[model samples]
Target: MTFSLLARCPETGRFGMVISSSSPAVAARCAHARAGVGVAASQNITDPALGPALLDALARGRSAPEAMAEVTAIAPHIQYRQLLCVDAAGRTAHWSGERILGTWGVAEGDGAVAGGNLLAHDGVPAAMVAGFAAARGDLGDRLVAALRAGRDAGGEAGPVHSAGLLMVDAASWPVASLRCDWLDQGCPIEAVARAWDVYAPQMAAYVQRAMDPREAPSYGVPGDE
Candidate 1:
């Protein structure tokens, strides 16, 4: 029911995830990341706690595989869960349990991993990783490219209704958290991309405004008098 990517940007040391699904608000449950740590995605009968648990393990100096092991060991209903994790060192690991939905699989690339369940085909995850690897520009752009690739390469077996992009830089707060909760006339992935296009240029300005309003650029809108 879902396809997702978790990634770390070597240039900026940021971690992020992009996700889409036939289910509404998939990313809120499936995509997870922590600054200076790593990323973990839990889907296919997702246990939302597993994402944070994996991050906690990574923060405690565990490798990706080790974290997955520890998390799955104690997590309830393990046989129904699918999890993928990438540590700060770029090590990756994943598990697709015995009872996950149709055509589920996973793939990895440099500093990234992709996974999917109830896919149109098993190739979706690999296509996402390849897309992330081949795309240019910042991490967000690459992630969105990967998402588009998954969509183009036959996404979910059913219509995809929701999508999200999440990223965190050095700061405690997220740098990007865009979601398309519902789509009536357009693709959710494309909607998220459009939101990013509007948000990207202003991100720095918004940050600057919070840090030092005097040094921040103008809002570029009217009525500042």
Candidate 2:
């Protein structure tokens, strides 16, 4: 019922994800990431705890794959979980349990990785990998390209209702955290893309301001307009 891709660009050191699902608002439940921390996506009976767990483990100096492997190895119901990760250093990892139902798999290469379960076909993850490899841009753009490829390859087994994307830089703030919980009407994936357009610049401004206080405008001034 869901498919997701998480990645980090080596040259830019940017991290992001593109996820879609027949389930409504898959974004709120599946996507979890923090600036200067790491990226995580857990779906198909999502374990929200995994978000913080993965990050904490990474913060403890574990590599992305090691953290993910440690976390997944002991999950009470490991067979049902599908998760992916890319730490701040650009390491990548993913898992699709063998006991999972219907078209479950994951592919990792270079600076990117994608995972899915209950997909429309087996080609989705591969298409996503190819898209990421072919994309020539920042991490966020490469993530979008991979998502588009998955969708073009044929998304989930049924209709999509919601989608989301998340990305964070090494700094304390984000460049974008675009999420659309309900998109049963319009194309959810495209809606997410549009939201990214609307929010990217603003988030960038916020990140920039946080990075350099001089770039931020002073609110209370004698001649403030």
Candidate 3:
């Protein structure tokens, strides 16, 4: 019912996730990240708490595989959940429980991992990792490219209604968080991509507004003009 990727930009030290699922508000439950810590995705009977728990271990100096093992070991229903993690060092780890849905698989690249359950084909996850590795651009563009490749390879067993992208940089807050929840009309992945297209250019400007509103560009919002 879900497909997700956790990636790190080795050059910039940025961490991000791109995910889509048949469930509404999937990102709210499945995706987690911290600026200099790591990223985690908990899905398929997701235990949202597991995400933060894994990050906690990573922050405590554990590697991604060790953190994932510790957290999932303590989870009550681990057999029903799928988990993935990538630490600040770009070390990756993942688990697809025995109870995971049909045609599930995992793929890993230089600084990324892709995984999915209830997929139309087993090759989907591999295609995603390959696409991300081959894409030429910033992390955001590469993420969208991976997502599009997954969709092209045949997504979930059914149409996915929600999608999201989350990116954390050097700030305490996320530099980008985009979502398309319960999309009954358009493709949720495409919706998120469109939102990213509009947001990426203004991402730095937004941070500037928070740090120094005087120098931030005005966009004619209310009193700004």
Candidate 4:
């Protein structure tokens, strides 16, 4: 059982996703994004390849709906997977197979989409979309807010053990990839949010370091000084 949101920031051309699940390492399997391409989630019976396949289609100039159609047409065992996508153009698409788990729901908003299976209520996804629409700051902030809203609306049918946040901008790689693979005691979403709070202020510095180390900020460690 899992819930996820995919979004694009029109102001900055960034794509992001936040996902949580009752399983371990949920993001490693379900979360997918590519800079200048799109973001995707492939869950419910979990076809990890589908995430990449959807992005590949988008990178090749397919719209979100077209990519979903193409992948579902060729993907094996398609009846068991739930898929979501948002292209660079901010167009969104999703597919919930006939065999998707219980109480599944999906909602789309301006430049964003949310979905979940085995959910506490059908409104969870809609709550996430609304939260994203209302929040401010960077794409990561809005994504985490959406995730919190889903939790408040009653998240998965059971306790979620893993959560993740992924984001990409103009870089060839993700600018943010934070994960709580497994949390035995507390909520993984909260864990991920705390991690984001710590990471967000430093995110730009890390990008600068990658792009042009000489102009990057100090590492604040003794050796760097």
Candidate 5:
């Protein structure tokens, strides 16, 4: 019921992930990333702790594969979860338990990995990876592109009601975290893309304000003037 991508931007050393699901608020439990560590997605049965555990391992100098191995071994009821990760060095790894949902798939690209369960088709994950590779602009942009491609290729077996985009740069917190927790009618992936379009231009300004308000740009609203 979920599809997700985890990636490391070689150009900027950033980490990001895009996820969508028939389940509401999927990202709230599945998407995780640390500024200088890595990005991870824990789907399928959805064990939220696995994402943070994976990143903590990456921060401790484990490669993507090593982190995945350690987590999957220690994680309880591991035979039902799907996980993906990309470390700071751009190394990627993925795990699909034997009991994964219907028509699951996994794919890898230059610096990204994608996985899906209960998908319309197994090709969705590869299409997402290809879309990420072909996209231009920031890591967030590429991730949105991947999500769109997954939908285009046949996303979940049923319509997705929730979606999220998460990214982390040099800051301690996420530079971009957008979500459509539940959409009763429209497409959540498109909704997230629209949100990113509105947020991307102001992302740097927000960071500047957080780091040093004196040098940051004005709010530009009526009250600020």
Candidate 6:
């Protein structure tokens, strides 16, 4: 059971993803991207190897659908796999294997794609895409908003054990790699959303400080000389 989203913000050009499933470290195995290439989410039946190579193909100017087709073609028995891909240029493509039961995925908006398997209904995917399209602001905000929408639309098939948020930019370090493992009760999507809210400002400041050391405000927090 899972409901996840991947997107790029129109305002910031920043790319990110939100994933929650019974799976462990859903972020690392299921999500992949290159700063100047594209972002992809392969789940339900993930193939950890495909993420990197697909992004490499995109970096070389492969369109979203082309790269996805090529990847799946390499392994025609991609049943149980639900994949979504969005290129650096904002193009999108998605595929849900026929044998992937309860899987519903969507690729929509300016630069966003939402997908899931073992979900409550097909509406989940469409809802995710619509939610992202309706979202405003930076990448963080859009990602959180998309997750919220997915939950409201009946996320997963039952309960949620964990949730993760990932963002990568063009640099040595990733833009964000934050997540919540094994949250309490039915849905952890909301809790993960709150985490991002608390973390964004601080991280943004930290990033600002790194970008311009002079802007690191010298707060008078006692002995903070």
- Candidate 5: TM-score? 0.99
Each prediction's TM-score against the native? Answer: 0.96, 0.88, 0.97, 0.99, 0.99, 0.88
Stretches of model 2 off by over 4 angstroms after superposition = 210-214, 217-225
After TM-score superposition, the amount by which residue 10's alpha carbon in candidate 1 deviates from its true location, in angstroms, is 0.9
For all candidates in order, the CA lDDT equals 0.91, 0.79, 0.92, 0.97, 0.95, 0.76
Candidate achieving higher TM-score, 2 or 4: 4
Between candidates 2 and 5, the one scoring higher on lDDT is 5
For model 5, the superposed segments whose C-alpha errors exceed 4 Å read: none
Candidate 1 residue runs with Cα over 4 Å from true position: none
lDDT tens per residue, model 4, 168-219: 9999999999999999999999999999999999999999999999999998
Candidate 4: give its CA RMSD in angstroms: 0.6
Candidate 6 Cα misplacement greater than 4 A, ranges: 184-186, 208-223
Q: Which wins on TM-score, candidate 1 or candidate 6?
A: 1
Lowest summed lDDT across 10 adjacent residues in model 5 is found at 216-225
The TM-score obtained by model 6 is 0.88
Question: Which 10 residues in a row give candidate 3 its minimum summed lDDT?
Answer: 216-225
Instruction: State the local distance difference test value for candidate 3.
Output: 0.92
Cα lDDT of model 2 by residue, 1-225, tens digit? 888888776666667788988888887888877776678888877877876678778888889989988898777887878888888787888777767778776788776778888888877888898988898766777777888888898978888888888887777555777777776587888888877767665665576668886776553459855
Q: What is candidate 4's local distance difference test score?
A: 0.97
Q: Write the per-residue lDDT of candidate 1 for residues 1-225, one digit (tens) a residue.
A: 999998888888989999999888888888888888988999998899999999999999999999999998999899999999889998888988999999988998888889999999999999999999999998899999999999999999999999999998877778889999888667999999999999988988888887788999987879863
Indicate the TM-score of model 3: 0.97
Flag clash pairs in model 3.
none
